[model samples]
Target: GVSRIKEFDKGFQEAVKLAFNTVGIQNAKPSNEIANTTPKTVETIKQQEIKQEIPSNTYTSNGVKYQVATTGNNSFLLINQDNNKVVANFYPSSLPNVYHVEVISDKGHYETIGYSKDNSIIIETKTGDKSWVTTTYTK
Candidate 1:
């Protein structure tokens, strides 16, 4: 289990770094080459697939079920089976004006998006703190 945990941490860091680097390099790369290129290997193709964002069925956790939806004015998150949509708001609590909202989707799901701050949410898949990753956007 320790080895597996180490492996996952390594992979997670590599994946995060690769994502940041890709964003930085994307503009510098020729658009025509990027647009026309095909995946050279199955692994590359899979990576491409993983980068795509797709909507999933609604879900919840513990005693609550939830879904994230967007309207013209605001992003809404509905909690419980009642399906009441709450307007997502961000303001900093205990840390200046920086506010954050955290959402954990159904288990086994990975999302790089969060409200208020980019990647500021944490999801615990295991029984420890290491099960989650968080990124906070700083002003």
Candidate 2:
């Protein structure tokens, strides 16, 4: 059965090649012929490295001061200024100027959505069961 299958495959390949030749289709150039063609010169560009300054802004929410800074990897760190502790991490969401905030503490782990507008960041945080509290931090 295997030998018969091999013969059938060989015959099919030949028939396909004949059909291509009948339609005036030519085979691709061999690797050596392609390599012998004239080589094209590629222009090299010297680009200056651009340095961007990351903004570290401080804001206040309910009289508590917080500092927000970029982690340089498309994420923002929310730090409490009183003790310099990272309270939450904000990651960019699909929507523009919107972020998903996550907080982990001895109490529990909480997740919420936040957005930046003007000079303020408004975040809707989960407080108790089925309760969402909105807080706005302004620069």
Candidate 3:
């Protein structure tokens, strides 16, 4: 079984190398520079700009930093210095019996995340709703 797995892995590696050579970046490592080979569509590029604008998320040219707000929801605001616009707005949803609240923004970055009854955490940050990065609750 292990031999079969190794053989499959070897074949996959060869195929990947062939694909890389086909694209002329033969020695590319599967990292950010290599993975970003797919050119961003105009819309996706816009979204990144929007994501950067959201003050609630605290994204900088350096990187997005997650911070727990001290003033609570909505009070935390960030102005996108680059675009001269507001970043995000936080609010509670009317939906009954829900854990997390909603963070809405003009840049189309909306999300809801909260803890579960079973002592687990859930996050939704998709088109309609997306769950992201649930970790073992610490502190």
TM-score of 2: 0.55
Of models 1 and 3, which has the larger TM-score? Answer: 3
lDDT of each: 0.40, 0.72, 0.41
Where model 3 places Cα greater than 4 Å from the true spot, the runs are 1-74, 91-111, 114-124, 127-130, 133-139
Q: Where does candidate 1 clash, by residue pair?
A: 91-99, 92-98, 92-99
TM-score of 3: 0.24
- Between candidates 2 and 3, the one scoring higher on TM-score is 2
Pitting candidate 2 against candidate 3, the one with the higher lDDT is 2
* Cα-based lDDT at residue 76, candidate 1: 37
Candidate 2 global CA lDDT score: 0.72
Ranking by TM-score: 2, 3, 1
Which segments of candidate 1 are over 4 A away from where they belong? 1-56, 72-76, 83-139
TM-score, candidate 1, is 0.23
